[model samples]
Target: MERVIGGSDRSAVGGRVPACPGPQAPGQGAVARSVTVRLDRRSLRGWHIRLLDQLGQRPDRRVRIAWVTQGSGLPGNAEVLFRLEAAIHGLPRPGLATAAEPVALAPYEARPDETVQTGDDIILDVSGAPAAPAAAPVWRLDFDGVPGEAGLLAALFARRAPVAALRGPDGAPVAVGRLGAESHTVMLAAFEDYLARTITLIAAALDGAGSPTLPDGAEAPLQPGRTFDLDGFGAGRRAAGGLARQVARRLYALCFQGPQWRVGWRQVVGPDLIDLRRHPEGGWNDLPDDGRRFYADPFAIARDGAVTLFVEEFDYRRGKGVISAVGFEAGGPRGRPEPVLELETHLSYPFVFEADGQAWMIPESHASGTIDLYRATAFPRGWVHEAVLVDGVVASDATLLQHNGRWWLFATVRTGGGSYSDTLHLWHAPHFRGPWTPHRRNPVLIDVGSARAAGPVVARGGALIRPVQDCRGGYGAALGLARILRLDEEGYAQRVETRLGPGAAWPGSRLHMLSAAGGLEFIDGSRPARPRLLR
Candidate 1:
């Protein structure tokens, strides 16, 4: 629900990225051509107008708008539910001032004198459709594999499907994304995030040189089985529960942190999680934490004799996180985690490792708008700032791996206005510290279920395995292991081979972040816990 894409306004992270121009063919007369976008005047919302504004601002491509005045609008209860939830939660109310006003479309609508015509080279239909006829190749914006406003309504009201995508006229997928609602209790926030992602997907598809394909055996297209009722039955039923749900949530927040994450670890033998593809027979041992705080994003390193574990220690009273470390011997943890690195800005995912005979850390500093390197000047404590690997972008959980004589930096970027856990961006450099170059296709992948970095990329068998956070259920709801098949200057690719979630072994509602070192494996998951006062 953050202000993502508006008229040339900057995002929380940085400046607005211009829309991608429609791809041009390779020929003597090669140049990006105009595309016709058909929209429903009746259902026109702020997002539709935003999308059109983006397309019109395409640097090299022109846009023609076609109005569908006869198109059906969303369920009446849709806006009602959004307003109800916003009022109770005190959520960000973007465009609420003119929520009831009709959008003026005359400025954007194609005039009769325009050179481009509908049903020409390509028709990008966003309206509830009898899609444009076969005369032109059509790229239809869909939600849960159903086109237009109805598709979004079906997912929000009927199926409540977490996954969404864009499909071509032939039903082949152009881009697929998981809805990123850290909690699904609020429907409007999730839909707004989805709309932001819609903009990113459409832009990428338009500008990408070659056809984009989902990873082999990845998320299959979701079918919203029965068409959603436009009569508002589902939306009406959901709205009726709003008051009760809001009251219950308020009571819950009074006593406990919405989600208190914890770390779990256990000694391993020959094969680790990357090898076994399942949890070990003996369940994990809890890494203890005081009731006043929670620990998460575990990473480990083997030193001369013992293993040191690093984590993000978040204090309830302070409401900020800092890097903490603990040492482990044969029996258990040396003691409680001690603060190792505290900064003015929030930090997490203490990505620690050894190189050049010195310990180093790259704690996620996305909130500061920089990815920094810190050298342990005095072993575990006395850390000193070393270098800034990348800046000017909000990058999360930056995991680094040296492969094929290159250092590959992987992290999910908060591009435009979508979930910070969905779009995967890559940067590489000859050394770990300097001169990083972004991949030609910067956002190599956009998958909410398996895009964010969970932990380090390690080698297994003859292949490289990367740990990714599966955020479809929500951010850090699950963990996944992906096989890095191709990664180089030209392109990047990966296949999610396995996904693990909380169960009897983990005993939590969320499981995310995986790491292993010195015959010890580490993981983290969410557990509900009341505040110290309540306890």
Candidate 2:
């Protein structure tokens, strides 16, 4: 009734694998082939069943999966297997294949209190039992090839799903963690970051320790063949509409929605409040920028009764950003903005802070695969690279704050392969620059609506307030203010209090970054940019 088959082997009669009866509605076509799924007893949980269920929903290709247990009987084996069979039945035409390589389902052991080195591949021995109690809850990682770091990374990237399918023994869904960054070469670092954060999220979910959040638009049920749409650009609709719609949509995206951003600012009277409705001219003051370049992530610092505003000036021609600063007085700007820091690669989010009576900055240098700190040698004009706080990773918006006798660093880092706007990570140290320790819950937040750091964290009324970008609609679509409830070496937590969007006060389509200093608040928004045609 059941047989193992190699991946490349095919049926002899029609050059196509035989169809099998599936669990879909009557009159649906049979499945193309059957594949054997080897479930490791150690990691046999609900997620495996969920994954199989998802795979069955694809209309183009249907696979019949044969369940083969690899390890000894466990407590939840019967229930998990039953769910898996039910899931298979829910698809269109499910049957066994005559010849195909068995898909291996295995466990990836992660500890809540320890770091997991993702280097070696492990096998499941038939005689082994489930994991111990002290270990974190096991979640099945489904793969076709030999288990290793590369294989795991490949599977994740191929899936392209923001959240992994994981569940506890109780059949309840577990919160999955991710490593979010903005670079291309540090996927392994992202994997390590994911492992660490997943363990923390599992522990917190079990003990009811902290409030964990999932990325916005991440609530959709995982479909077997469906891919996560990063920009919600109606790709699925276009794909369903036919080839012509797809082509039209692609062309529309290419012509209209090219890269562009604009900066806006208003004066504030207090630390805890920002009223966009009360601008000098009943509207936001737009920073003057040439059509070729735009400004964003505006940060202001006051020194000796003078205010200096720094922003990320991105030139569309060069396709990179440089740090620029402009002086401001009581009425308006003292002069035009001038470039202060230029690098070979892209830079943004000029997070500036004063420590030890000196000015320092940590602009987003994720393109270089590191978070580098810079020291200002001469006020707002000269800057030199000072230290590398974290390396071998793509970290963005390196916002720094000093509180409770310790210094903290916050950023939205890309850990593996996903959107760069979702994973918020934290680090801490005793001094502004030195050896830093990653939080046990490294990815403190994963919500696309509020994960990316928008501006500096400010202390007000015995509480810390953090500005976050709400990218649920799109990148830098809105701004959110969160109050930190708990933050320590063991864990982290926050609650978003207010969300500000682009509208009456600021006439634009997006509002992302926010910073306040010397009773002035700086914000940025996006507007339609005129397209430039080449001669």
| Per-model TM-score versus the true fold | 0.56, 0.52
Residue-level lDDT of model 2, residues 1-535, one tens digit each, is 2222211222344355333445431112323222223343333333333333443343332222223333332222122222222222232111111001122211112123322112211111111223222122232321111121122233333544234323333323333344342322333233334434433443333223322234553432333454432111133222223423322332233324443467876665443344332333456677887655678899999877878899998654344578999998656677767999998766788988888899999998775778898999998978999999987676778888787889888888764335567898889999989688888887888888888888988776678888889887766778898888987888888898888887777766678888877766688977654464322
User: How do the residues 420-487 of candidate 1 rate in per-residue lDDT, one tens digit apiece?
Assistant: 78899999999998689999998999999888999999888789999999987766788999999999
Deviation of model 2 at 403, angstroms: 1.1
Q: For each candidate, what is the lDDT? A: 0.68, 0.54
RMSD of each: 16.7, 18.6
Which ten-residue region of model 1 has the weakest summed lDDT? 1-10
Off by over 4 Å in 1: 1-259, 528-535
Which whole-number lDDT from 0 to 100 does residue 282 have in model 2?
52
**Poorly placed runs, candidate 2 (over 4 Å):** 1-259, 269-281, 528-535
Best TM-score among the predictions, by candidate number: 1
